[model samples]
Target: MNGASALEVIEAHDGTIDLMVTDVIMPEMDGPTLAKEVLKTNPSLPIIFVSGYTEDRFKDEIGDNAHFLPKPFTLQLLAEKVKEVLS
Candidate 1:
């Protein structure tokens, strides 16, 4: 889903969401920006950011609660990342 819809879902869930997986670059809002906004209310929320770019570029932007998963990742890799972040 897009960033705006993701934001709405998170709001609708009232901070019950365990984690969020999003793309680094999106049409309306970027993942880091979305994460930053979400963190305002759900500071502890874990986020996984997916993109084709290098992880280093987003490391500082994403801060502690977020992880980077480059594009072309497998379902297994995505699962592993979710598990790792949720842990």
Candidate 2:
């Protein structure tokens, strides 16, 4: 879903999300923007941003508790990232 829709979902759920996985580039809102918005309320929320571009592209925007996963990743790698971030 798009960032706006995802934000709506988060609001609907009372912002009690454990983790978030988003793409770096999106239509409504970019990943970093979404992350900033979400982080406003849930500061410790862990977010995983996936993109076709390199991580360096978003280094400054991605702050604490946020991570980057390059595109074309395997299920194993995704799982590993999730585990690493959640931990």
Model 2 spans with C-alpha error above 4 angstroms: none
Candidate 1 per-residue lDDT, tens place, 8-82, comes to 877888437888888988878788889989989988888889999998877888886568888899999999998
Give lDDT for model 1: 0.84
Question: What local lDDT does model 1 show for residue 5?
Answer: 80
- Show the lowest summed lDDT stretch of 10 residues, model 1: 8-17
Compute the lDDT of residue 18 as modeled in candidate 1: 82
lDDT of 2 by residue, 1-87 (tens): 888888878878953689999998988988899888988888888999999999887788886556889999999999999999998
TM-score of each prediction: 0.87, 0.91
